[model samples]
Target: MKRFSALGAMLALAGAAPLAGAAPQPPSCARPEWPQEARRYELEGVTTLNFRMGPDGRAIEPTVARSSRWAMLDQAAIASLSTCVFPAETVQRVQGKLLPLQFVWKLQGPDRVPPALVEGSCAASERFDRYVPFDKGVSGDDGVLVRLLVRGDGTPYGVKAEAGGADPALAQAAVEYVQSCRFAYPKAGASPGSPVSGRVLLKQ
Candidate 1:
């Protein structure tokens, strides 16, 4: 299922001059795609952010005003909103206060199934505790998809990047990242001999 609903093109920007005496709302801009990892784990929340407009009408020093209680969602919101540009005059007018932006993440449809942990699945070991540095200059889609072969003892025996358009260095980095992770194994009494595949998002 397509979890994200696109209002328009992924990178399309809708430029509208801010009207005087109008209710405040997020500027019309490209919508952020839900983090794949977050969507896989059924994580959902509202992330609110604020940032000052740069001299070029771009977002500068964006900060999270209210967390969605999830780091991935917060980062995703920040990454997308950073691309928003405003008129220089409008920015000057609102110079005293940071522009407010909010992203609401909700799973589509009813009867949603809760995410379940699979035995010996490396995905079960995915962790968000390690923070990925946010570079405002980097594209949100910059990431590599990795495949893994897991051992019965909760360790990956084989890790490789799927052949595709991702940069070679980025792919290597992703392989190493997965190789360093200790995956989830089956219970002591359970049989654990099978090839399991998993992937990680390296959104920088």
Candidate 2:
């Protein structure tokens, strides 16, 4: 079985008020577990999350300050960091401040990590933009789910898409969008012409 884990969080002061006295101890944070979906795709990246400390020492209003390229990894970072707890003294030192925490997702072992979707590709492509207007204005938070086969060379093919409880027309648009995009896998680790199944969630 493949193993995936996140590195220890790197913390930085984001507009945190200067301490007049001694610096407080660092907060206890539970790093996020790598998403299985990302693991299956061999995705890796660093996601930065920002949050304030609540009176009870738990993270408050945790939000992704910067995406890890993949939504799955970003969501995983937010969900896990929300459970972080600052010491009472640390909370006061950083009260009402948005602290930045960086979580890095890295695959363990010798196998090379597979390619991930290029940043700002696929659903964010110009092709997707052209199709969106003609999608009959079908828009919702419930994005379309698309499954497709990607060649070892990173070419996407045979997209099978489905709408998430919306009009089926969205599926057709998602198919075209997915096929137009590219993946970034190395030929050394991937077999040429070998087809692999890939999934993506397309949202407006």
Candidate 3:
């Protein structure tokens, strides 16, 4: 009873230096917002971003270090900072440091209506069958709900593991399979769908 689908991945040009990998420290608590259009259509995903701490201790040139496949989501994340206060002392310690964050889009509702890019639920390629190669014995569960961020053009921008949990191997496989997928929303039109929370039941 599971239906696995494919998603899209966008390639962005290298702009500024990549953000520092050092774990996030204190005072870096700026949360991103969900795009209005994306929320209307129920599109969700994670936009991993990076911004440079200019010499003046203010944020500058925030860019999409990693795309969520949804242009709207990415743009929303970049515009999150209006007053970035950087401590010159801290910047000195981390001379060439860039900030990195993963802005997420998760919906809260009881509706299971799948998000679409056009006028209806998205249409996916018939490639799910061959995506995951796991043994039924260790797959852990027969089914799991996968939350996805579907872009307006029908590309699944992001995929997430839902429920309390699932077999480690199975969950990893499911995510990888979905990430490598490609889909289309014939009538829904191009818009972001945050949580295309679809139930995926494994094949016997």
User: What 10-residue stretch in candidate 3 is worst by lDDT?
Assistant: 1-10
Candidate 1 residue lDDT tens string, 83-108: 67666566666655555666777766
TM values, all candidates: 0.45, 0.54, 0.42
Q: Write the per-residue lDDT of candidate 3 for residues 1-204, one digit (tens) a residue.
A: 112111222222134233332213333434455556566435556667776666766667777776655567677766765344545465655546666656665555443434432322222434234332121121235654455666665567567644334676666566766665555544433334534545445665
Error of 2 at 186 (Å): 9.2
**Total clashes for model 3:** 21
Candidate 2 segments whose C-alpha is farther than 4 A from its true place:
1-3, 6-24, 110-174, 177-204
lDDT of 2 by residue, 1-204 (tens): 235545433344443344223146766776566776667555556778777778888888888887655667788888877767767887666678666767777667665344455555555653244222112221334445455546766777666553535466766776777787777776456643322333334434
Please give the ranking of all candidate structures by TM-score, highest first, separated by commas. Answer: 2, 1, 3
- The lDDT values for all models are 0.53, 0.59, 0.51
Whole-model lDDT, candidate 1? 0.53
RMSD (Cα, Å) for all candidates, in order, is 11.4, 8.3, 13.4
Residue pairs clashing in model 1 are none
